[model samples]
Target chain A: MTASTQMIEEGTALEVDGLVKRFGDLTAVDGVSLTVRAGECLGLLGPNGAGKSTLIRSMVGRVRQDSGRVTVMGKAAGSTEARMALGWVPQELSIYPRITCRENLGSFGRYYGLKGQTLKDAIAWCLHWAALEEKQDDVAKTLSGGMKRRLNMAAGMLHRPKVVLFDEPTVGVDPQSRNRIFEMIEALRDAGTAIVYTTHYMEEAERLCDRIAIIDHGKIIAEGTNEELVEKTFGRRSQVLARFDGETAAIEAWAGRHGGRVKGETAEFTIEQAGEIAPLLDDATKAGLELEDLTLRRPNLESVFLHLTGRELRD
Target chain B: MIALKRDRGALVLSFVLPLAFFSIFAVIFGRQGGGTPTVKLIVVDQDQSQASAALVKGLQSESSLVVMMKPEAKSKSAPAPADYTAATAEAAVKAGDAPVALIIPAGFGQHPIAFGPDAGGSTLELLNDQSDTIAPQIVVGLLQKAAITSMPSAMADEGMKYADKYVGGFTPAQKAKVDEELDALRKAEADGKTGAGSGDSGNGNSGNGSAGAGIVAVNVRAVVGENKKSPMISFYAAAIGVMFLMFTASGSAGALLDEAESGTLERVLSTRVTMTKLLAGKLVFNTGLAFVQLTAMFLWGWSAFKLDFFSHLPGFAVMGLCTAFAVAAFGMLLASACQTRAQLGALSTLVILIMSSVGGSMFPRFLMPESMQKAGLLTINAWAIDGFTKVFWRDLPVTDLWPQVAVLLGVGVVLFLIARRVARRWEFS
Candidate 1:
């Protein structure tokens, strides 16, 4: 194995130490620190305005932190060597719309000082990786939304950097395209590339992330594997979700009396075992509540996010 | 309409554009500060006689003419510069320091007027810049009136001398003839006269010695813009072309704002490309685009307006490149100063239009008031048009373009540096 490849395989590909970023009086990232190793995907899960984007931006060298340090491949962030080793796919569709997909990749590859055969090979690999071989020469503006998003991702990764930050890359894409993106990311992860993925979707984190960091108000409140987060927040417990057809105030009062959260049309309760759901339903029936629906499921990332922040994942 | 009302940029372009245009047009074409455009006239009184002195004094008395005998003093208490000679006066007109110059030849006051068989008098030479067609006519007409009104003794003495040489060589006889002619003119005027005085009101070369045909002979020579196949073609090309080039440059530079909004700028910064390098690339692209726009304009002028483009290619290229660089830098500054595309649109339009109007694009700076003409020097368009004028109209060699080239390149560098400073916000956070 090549020495550079070996080093990347065994080293910390990305590291952030006490990164503090502030805008006016609002601290967007408050003394946050994390590390991503090779062959691992770290997903940042948060609700809206939870500082997930700010943290990712700081790591990518797009945001200048007021304090602390970020290093890629053991070099300082925003330095020439570090920049060459880092790749950022912003949440916004950042590719040039007037140019074709191949041209966009060529332009970005040139920015990274790639040329000739190397640039051509990088373009080809990115096209194939993004499943955009057929639309390689099509103008980005004319492409479908998912294709454009894929091209945006491909442009940032043309140099094959050791660390890649994908900021909400699957936003606004259809199901099939999201699946395609997931497959592309999985391939990158299997190639031993350290990746930071941020999304509001709970399932995406559950399926792809080796570890998940939950951020709220510029601080990481909980971080672990999906099972670990759910276990940490709600141990040995399953959630009881019941929809009762009754007066809104009466249902809210009954759920409150039973120590359940009435969110929208459903009442949620954290039970240690599945057997506890029968008593809750029986209590609901005795309170003159007509049960419309009920679900017994293990607690998940969404449940953990809710239990920790008292807000929906999409709020 | 509602959208337009809400968008300040569109609102400014809609109402403020017309108002700005009107104000500039009024300041240029209408009366300004209750004063007329003062013509700059350099006077060289070689004869130094009574008639010459009186004529100089009369021209100085004219509020519409700024008559200068020598260049301005360097300091408040410094020794005055030498008075201009005939050669220096002609050079001043050619150098565009003044539109017209009057050089009273030697012995002009000896026989200022000639109306005999030998109407031999030293002609007062009026050297003019052909770029300003009106200044020569105004100078010539004013010269005749000033000579008649300011130097009546010189006119009569010459008339008497002419009569003595032609008729009887007697003062009494000459005086009697002049009185008889005056009585006859009075009678003709009292009878509602028509064509009873003179003819050939232009040039006054008749030597008829009649009223309105002029009393003094003046030689009018165009010291600049004399050999042009067409008048003001190069001036128009440079003027109008530079104005639109600014628009093209600013609009092209607005792409930076686009990339910033779309997040491509952020992504690009994450790569090895720094903000300085990105702005440099954009400057080169914008400069080339402006040069192409200027070339197309001149090529069209060459084909249609008989612009002397082929012979002045070297000067044109130098001036064109410098002007494009300066304007591109200006665009970059505007783009970096503004936060959004709408702000850029409004600000660039207002600034470029104002610059164009004041910089000799809408009208020649020579016709503006002296203060406005001096103000024209502050804009890139003025320097560019001046350089192009020297090349195509004055037929000057490329070496003469150093002043303009220096200003434009310096302006470009300074503006680019400022733009780079202003663009730091996009570099991080």
Candidate 2:
């Protein structure tokens, strides 16, 4: 075990160490490691095909890692005890379409060994949490896209597991459903359930994650809180974006001296303090530069991801 | 098209499976042009007299019957003891030793088989296994022809006796005329000529009176076994019922692929349920469904066609359960082999259709060529149909159906083991 593997603490809900998975010549997930403590939500932020899904699958034991260990509540991953304490909300709609919502819940609940009144209470609570009580008798295929997404999330959490893994749980749902799902997930987090959420949406990660791990090309290049990531990537610098009207050769020269980059008619200057924007504007005015529009923007997770990976979060 | 290229299993199923089934069915029906094959007949002759020899010779002369006589070491002229007793002959027919049995009674030749109000007729017992409807009828026709040929000589001998006793006081001229007419009548009967007016030509009193009393009628006693007289309807009912049950069971079991596609299979596997429990539950449900479907078809056959379904309920029940289990396991195996629902459907349809065609569901195995009949035995459909025939048509007791039941259950066990191994990769991944 390496230092990362030894980082597993007593209250850690999930600990993955030196995980590596490969398909033929292509390594889908490189030697990546992370841990999520109880009551914490770790956002796995990455672009499509960034090995986020592969890493999460390894953690859940859906796919065997070539070399590594995933422990859930101190038990080996894929073990019965590990599976019993784990919950998974897959990216796809996993419910049986021909069956009614209640029937789908009942059948999946039985898989968790829930029975009698415990199963009954879990089902009732899931229905209320998913806001599907009114459409409980409706067939899953007949429900709107958002309702299905909600039900999918509810099904994963029905067993009241110690750890829940969500892989883009709100991929194609309505905004309202997405908000409701976030609320439910937050409630679970408050109730001491560790969550590992993977998504390409930067805003969702920024709003929901306690800590963000930006993965690229099967490797986690950065891992920290959103504020920490922003500061580390940009060093407390804010961007000043100025759009000029014409071929602004003078503005490009002034931007070069000020340690800024210019693209087409736009010039962006990275300033150390917000007050430095006044002196920059004065300098640009004296250089005979015409600014059509100017705006000051703060650095964020999106910037951190773009700076670290040299690509947009959605790319 | 790209997916098809990627999935070689699906590509093979789409093209090769249908073609293979077509080839098999074509070969089966192509060689079925020769009409009505010969039936094997077992002869148990208890009477070694000359008259019984004539009866045996008459049956042997028929082109349609292949007579199988017991080996005897005695001289031709002596009364050779019967090689097989009546009980033994019946046992041979029941055990499928022969399709038909003819038991000649001890006094068949010694006592005249008298026809008319005062004479009692002797019966030649014909035992039929009743598995094939056409074979028994052919055997019956051949036996009747043999009786017709042999009965005339005995009747003419009786006629000669009547002439000496009843016409003793007649004048020489009248007796001479009667003898001439009797000789002509015997010749006409031997020549297979029959008309009511020809015998009435001369000596009206002696001709008609002697003809009526001297004609010894032979009774053909047809002893049909437990399957009843006609077995076609019941035989077909079982065959078609089992075939359709296979289709329904396979279709239902294909839901596993659908579940996999929907990701529900992965979700379920992530829970506390083991892969073994999941597959066992599916097998049980599919088998139960198939059993109910087959039973409904059987009950329908009983109500609509009056098939003797309830008479041998135990045998039928055993066959139904075993067949359902076997078919369910087969369906699961197909599902495990294929990655998608379309592949499963195509492959299973191909297999079931070919099996049913060769195994006597669409056409009777008896009607097919000899090679095809032997090939059909390798399929589950053949064993199931044969078991059902034993219960419904042969009226065989439950104990006799063990071979078929054991074969079907054994197939189920083997298929289940293979399917379980293959399906684990699908479920756990």
Candidate 3:
């Protein structure tokens, strides 16, 4: 490999340290730091106004940080070299509505210095990748919301940069298109392109991200793998929920010994391990508690986000 | 109430701007109904004689003429040389320094003013640029009135000179008879009576001489180029056409702000293209749009009013292109300065209405007060209208439009530079 290519491979594909951006008195992105390795997908999860967009913007050099630094592929952010290596998909639909899909892709591709046969090839590939080959000649305004969102992604990815950032790419898309977008992202990741995806959907983050960062109030309050975060926030405990057929004052007395609580005919028990669930059920049965339904719940990112931030993931 | 508060700028412009312009133009064109509008004339008196002085003073006293000339020096010992000459006066008119130049030739006061079909009538030459159709006519009419008003005195003066030369040698009795006959003729002419006096029998030979000497005529000659006559309808058509063209160009230029709001501008900025190049592309497109609009309007005028469109196509094209470029640059500057489309609309409307009102688009600048006429020179509309007047009214050659073209293109370049600086936010914001 060339020395520059080898050097890029040795460092993180994207790195941000102590990045702070303020608008007037509000710190939009407060001293946030993160890194994404090559071929790894880092999902940025946050509620509205959680500084996710600001952080993403700073990473792409769209907004200058008040402090600290952001670098892409070993180059400073906002530099031409860094910009040439970065791809961004903003939350809003940024395609030209009056132009055809093919023309929109071609125009954006040219902005990236793609021209001649290379530009045509990129446009053709993006049309097929976005599943818009048939509708390539139609004006973007006439497309459905899902189609436009897909096209928005396709436009950003035409350059095939080393680092790609998507800011809430599937906010208002249909389920089918959202799944397709997820698949497309997965393909990018498998192709060894580092990705930073931001979304409010926890399930999407849990399924797609290799590591997830939960941000709140302009700070990354928590960052880890899904299981690591769950264990760190809530310990290795599982909850067993039992609905009784009748009122069970007797079961409440037995379950209180095992760190469980009873409300009316339902009993909820927090156990240290999954093996403890059977013994608790045996005790409940011995206490003459007639159970109608029982379910075992494991801790997840949603609960971890709640446990760490004391708020829901989407709040 | 919410909508009103949201669009307060448009609200203010819709009501306040119209009322303001109306009050202004009403005061300007309203009082013009009672009296003839004055024409600015420059006079060069080559003949420094009594008759020439009297003619100049008489024209100066006329309400319809504002005479401008170099004043004589105050020192009687060392008088200042005359700075104004016939060539300079003619040049002044051609360069639009004044509407008309009235040159009194040498020896104009020596001969008797001729009123009838006399061959050697003293001619007062009026030189005009012909851009102004109405002003020249007014000047000509004022000259005619001045000549007619001075006729009786001129006839008496000639009659006295004739009596001194020919009748001086006559005998006292003969001279007394001739005097008695002249008094009777004067009384007869004044009493609405036309009959030869009874002394006609004795003074019949001198009667012919006295009668022939009493008539004086003045001829007024206009020096103007061919095809310089422009009808009032055609003038207004061109004026109103350019005024609305500015409005339309500004409106179209507002599309830049729309694109910004829609995120397309931001998307384009994210590309490798620099902001300056993008703005330049937009300027070119808007300028072309303005040019096409003006061309269509002129074509319609040609079909409707028989305006000389094809005859002066070269000059017209130059004027249209330069004016379009300036107007487009102006519109883009407004767009770049304003943050929103509504603000652009209101502010551009206010500016264009004021400029059009003061710049001879709605009313002739010649009819405005002198102060307003000077103020009109500060607007693009003034230069644009002046250029079109050269092509359509004066029928001037294409080369003559260079001054207007230079000013317009220069303004366009300057405004585009300012717009480029102001529009940097579109790339970074």
* Candidate 1 vs 3: which has more lDDT: 1
Tens-digit lDDT string for candidate 1 (A1-315): 764456455778888889899999999888888889988999998888889888887777778889999878877888999899888898999999999999999999999999999999999999999999999999999999999989989998889988899998999999999999999999999998999999889889888999999889898899889889988988898898999899888789888987888988799988887777788888888889999998888888889999999998888
Q: What is the lDDT of residue B299 in candidate 3?
A: 88
Best by DockQ: 1
Candidate 1: where are CA atoms >4 Å away?
A: A1-10, B32-36, B76-78, B115-118, B161-213
When candidate 2 is compared with the true two-chain complex, its DockQ is 0.58
Question: Candidate 2's residue-wise lDDT over B1-429, tens digit each?
Answer: 899898765777778877887787777665433434556778888887655666676667665566878634468886765566778777767766666687777887765455454655555666766565555556555544455465555656556556666767557787787678766765665554532222111111111211212333333233335526445767887789878988887788888889888888888888887778888899999999999998888888888877777877888789999999999998888888888877777777778888898888998886566688899988888999888877776667889988999999999999999999998787543
Q: Which ten residues in a row have the lowest lDDT in candidate 2 chain A?
A: A1-10
- Candidates arranged by DockQ, highest first: 1, 2, 3
Evaluated on CA atoms against the true complex, candidate 3 attains a DockQ of 0.43
Off by over 4 Å in 3: A1-7, A239-271, A274-295, B30-34, B70-88, B105-107, B110-121, B144-152, B158-225, B228-241, B298-318, B391-403, B424-429
Tens digits of lDDT, candidate 3, A1-315:
764466576858998899889999998888899999889999998778889888887877778678999988988877778878888888889888999999999989988899999999999988888899999999999999999998999998788888999888998999998999998889999999999999878899988899999888899988989988888776878767788775466877876877766766767766786787778778878877777899888878877776667667777
Task: Write one digit per residue (lDDT tens) for candidate 2, span A220-257.
Answer: 89999999888888897887888876556877898888
In candidate 2, position B418 carries an lDDT of 97
Candidate 2's displacement at residue B345, Å, is 2.4
TM-scores for all predictions: 0.90, 0.80, 0.81
Q: Please compute DockQ, using alpha carbons, for every candidate against the native two-chain complex.
A: 0.83, 0.58, 0.43
CAPRI quality level assigned to candidate 2 from its DockQ score: medium
